[model samples]
Target: MDKRINDLKKMYMDIKIPDNIDSIIDEGVKKGEIKMKNKFKGNLIKGISSIAAVFLIFTVSINASSAFANSISDVPVIGKLVQVLQFTGNKAQGGQVTDGVDIGMISLRKAKNSEEVIIKFNKSQDNIAPCYSISYEKYPYSMIFTVSGVRKFSAEKDFEALKQSNFISDSYNIITLDDSAVRFAINFKKPVKYEVKEYKEPAQIVLSLKECEKGNDKAAYIVRTASYPQGETLGILEERLCGFENIRIVKDDKGTFAVEAGTFESEEKAKERIKEIMNKCGSDIKLYIEKREANQLPKQMQ
Candidate 1:
């Protein structure tokens, strides 16, 4: 065994004589392995970067597409849309409704002229249950153009309604009372709509007689205004009060009920006649004379 070991050592020394040969070979192999590993790592990093960039692009594209879709929804239509509807005259069957008040929905209708548009209401479908009056004004800022007389409806909320009202009217056919001024009224069968935008008329009926310090004789005939809690219409009331043979109702520019009874000549005679009226009318009455026709007064009063 000693001889064999000595022989193996002599053979190894003869085969390799260079110093640090094992170290040099080991370093070269290790460097080659490291370079290959580095190359593989570099390829992995590039692949990862490419994947990340694609994923980011896809995410941004998705978000941008979604935003564009949202913006398009807010634009207004370029043209008008028409809807054909059937009018059975069966008033609106359901929805929020109030008592004694008529609710009507509106739609626009263009005339043959096209420029002229009308807010047409569906009257055929409108019905009144138990008979009632319906007064409606266009919503927002429109005046009521149509007022239906008292009619009967089978259902409570029955009124076929359509409209094309656009412009707003500050004045309409409704009469509005101003302040506490005493006003005598006679509703004619065909009563004209009076627009008294302002209250400029002096109080025709002086509630306080003390305001008129002058003796009653000073003023010939006095114009009086009175109202009844219940009774006949305005024309009927005027006929009863003004015993004139012919009576005509004319609408003053101010929109007041003027009973132009036959012009009187004698203020004293008119005053005497007023006394009779006071006795008959009981209490609430107002008196006035034709301010323009003072010449019609009695010779002394004039």
Candidate 2:
């Protein structure tokens, strides 16, 4: 009997366990069994079954020593003995365990002639790559900013304050997604250009928006209605306005393509044409009267 007990101890000692042995044990206890508290100490060969006694002793030992339980919880039939323990439960909860580490509330700071937006986190998240997506829209002329890998974000107070700033003329909307991402739909008084910068230590993302410069020449004037990034939108604009005379698709230094309906000798003539276009295209289309010297006009338009 002594030799048998020694052999059982040695056999279990060589078994290997899993990292999530505690969770597995908790799941088993939730099903029915009472958790063992005291170390096993009983007669080796009492009027009970030897195998049952040895199994109970092993279970009690596992419950008493965390290191021992972790070392042998994955051993073949012994591992499956917990009933609730399975191969995939450990991985299923891994994301939830790590989701707490992420960016938190966002704030906006109004600067003279510009605005600065900052993202804040509980601790340094320098190791995580900040991924973002951007979209621009016409009519009211708005830009959408979507940032991923954020745990939470609140912009109510700062967004309200930004609306009152001289640089921001309209309201903004913020939406938090199910996958820990945030989206911001922002409208400006006029067309603006923006840039993004990042900082470590406390882990912050800074966004700056400034009004885009049109030009300084003033000998002639053009009725410019809309601008789009130099791609599909510009191609569609060109096709839509192909029948109109004096329509020019001009690419700016910032890489945006501006659509000019016509050039006139005076701002009044440009404004008059702008009114006609606005009436035809609907009130949402806002046009800008851009001044240009005779020499600055594109050779084709001149």
Q: Which candidate achieves the best TM-score against the true structure?
A: 2
lDDT of 1 at 286: 53
lDDT of 1: 0.32
lDDT values for all models: 0.32, 0.52
Off by over 4 Å in 2: 1-103, 127-129, 174-177, 214-302
- Cα lDDT of candidate 2 equals 0.52
Candidate 1, residue 7: how far the Cα is off, in Å = 99
For residues 1-302, could you state the per-residue lDDT of candidate 1 as single tens digits? Answer: 99999999999778965799899999999999999999999999999999999988877765766433333431231112122222132111111111332212222222222211122112223222111122211111111221232122222121121223122112212221212111112211111211111000110100000111222222223343332222234445565565543232333334444443333446766666566666875445454444332212111110
Question: On residues 1-302, what C-alpha lDDT tens digit does candidate 2 reach at each position?
Answer: 99999999999997888889999988998654432322122343343578888898898988886545644642321211111112231111001112333555455555456766655544324433245555443223345555565565554346666566444554444423235565555555555666655544444455567877742424677777455654556455554555565554554334355666877888888888877766666576556877755323222221
Clashes of each: 23, 0
Q: Which residue pairs collide, candidate 2?
A: none
User: On a 0 to 100 scale, what is the lDDT of residue 265 in model 1?
Assistant: 48
Q: How high a TM-score does candidate 2 get?
A: 0.34
Model 1 TM-score is: 0.21
